[model samples]
Target: MANSLSDRSSGGHQAPKNKKYQMKREALEQVIDKHISNIEKHSKKLPGTFDKEDIHDLRVNYKKVRAFLRLLQLEKDAGDLHISDKLKSLYHHCGTVRDWQLFLEELHDVGIVDQLPDCMHRWHRQVFTYKEQTVHAIETTHFKKLLHGIIKELPRQLQEDTVKQFMHQKIAAIHILLLAAENEKDLHSIRKQIKDIIYCIRIFKSDWGIPFPFRGWKSEKELNEMASSLGDFNDQCLAISLLQPSYICKCDYKEQHILRNLQINWLHQKEARQRQLLYEVQELHVEHAF
Candidate 1:
């Protein structure tokens, strides 16, 4: 991946002469627009496949497509990124069911289902209801029809000059936000913003073989280490938030107690990973400042 990124970066010098670069950019935008269109047109078919595994796969696809579209919009502004943000919120909410489902599956896999609360078993039964609601919301014809109206107007909005201007504005805004994130709440927000940037880089890296912007901006190994740390912290945070005491209150059996201990261990490991990453991120920023 790094080698390909290097080759592509070098190849761009010769690309100014080729219409292929322009065409590819256009094609990329069109493909993204088409996918958005598909979601808008067929969202009503969403709820039938709301199972845990299926929802997890859908979440992955949604993240990739949403990330790709946002990156493309940064460079091309053909679609409304706010729409993508809304979709991400919905996706995150929908993830609660999948997370719980995984938690239960792992418990069963380890042969500890009997250790959990009777209430947890009951909650697991209703997981499908939450899943179905999320799917239904995403698939609603009304929502898609509203999005279709805005998205279909893309080609005109995505002029190269406009996209360039849009990117400049966005980069500047994110930079300011990064600089202003001082408190824990601010840092939390910055982490989300940076994660989105990383997501975009990963998507572009896979799709176009481009060097990630962060690569040019900092030490590759250090940045990666920090990113890994941030990811661990975020995952822990998500797990903690999703596992309500209501879930735990029901998990009070001795073996069920063991499962809770495992969760605590997981949280500790995640925190340790995050602290290491956070220190590294700060160190790099200080070094860069000089």
Candidate 2:
């Protein structure tokens, strides 16, 4: 698998100081610097003959950068460095391609491809066209400019704060949110927050030599398991979302029957996954409370 920016370490060459631990402004700066460089490097490859991994890496890195920005609450700072919307739009473009790829891959993995009705080939072709158009959009000068602008502004937007304090606040906030979640949308939000927190913790550990400060709650491994569960659920949701639109169109009876079965299975899986996620969330809340 091609390594996404998130997969790479933020500190490439810098050595952590042996002095007392502090989450200085420069720690965040180093993260932004590395991410910006990674984004630029990956974006350059986007216009080439890239595969699924390339697009996946590009999108994941972009989200890491955005997550870092949000972590620092810098999105609206002075209104000059607000690039979340641009990054989000670009991220969505990548997601569309990725989701389609995953959808097909899911079918193949489940032995459903061979069983799929012939009319579903039309859906596959439609996904191909969508991927092509999205890739072309990435090649635009405007997209490049937006990426460059983010790279240029992010360094100047970082603020100094104690790493311990930052971690506590962010983690506590996420815990509260997770505890309050009542539905899939809320659970999805918590998953994203957990991911961002884990990313930041890893960066601090690898780049700044700071250890994870939280205790008696969730370990990184546990958090990763939770995220993976949520990810599977989200994938099912995306597959269903993409499949639903084609339902309204006219198709052969056999085709419709297969499609309906696929949709029903996906929906059933999603519901089961939701219940499992909710139970996990409840467990997380209990662990955190003690």
RMSD (Å) of each candidate, 1 decimal: 6.7, 6.1
Alpha-carbon lDDT, every model: 0.51, 0.62
- The Cα RMSD in angstroms, rounded to one decimal, for candidate 2 relative to the true structure is 6.1
**Candidate 2, 75: how far from true, in Å?**
11
Candidate topping lDDT = 2
State the weakest 10-residue window (summed lDDT) of model 1.
14-23
Q: What's model 2's lDDT at 243?
A: 64
Off by over 4 Å in 1: 1-14, 17-29, 37-57, 64-81, 84-90, 105-112, 117-119, 138-147, 153-188, 202-215, 219-228, 250-267, 283-290
Per-candidate TM-scores read 0.61, 0.76
Looking at candidate 2, the ten consecutive residues that score lowest on lDDT are 1-10
Report model 1's TM-score to 2 decimal places: 0.61
> Clashes per prediction?
2, 0
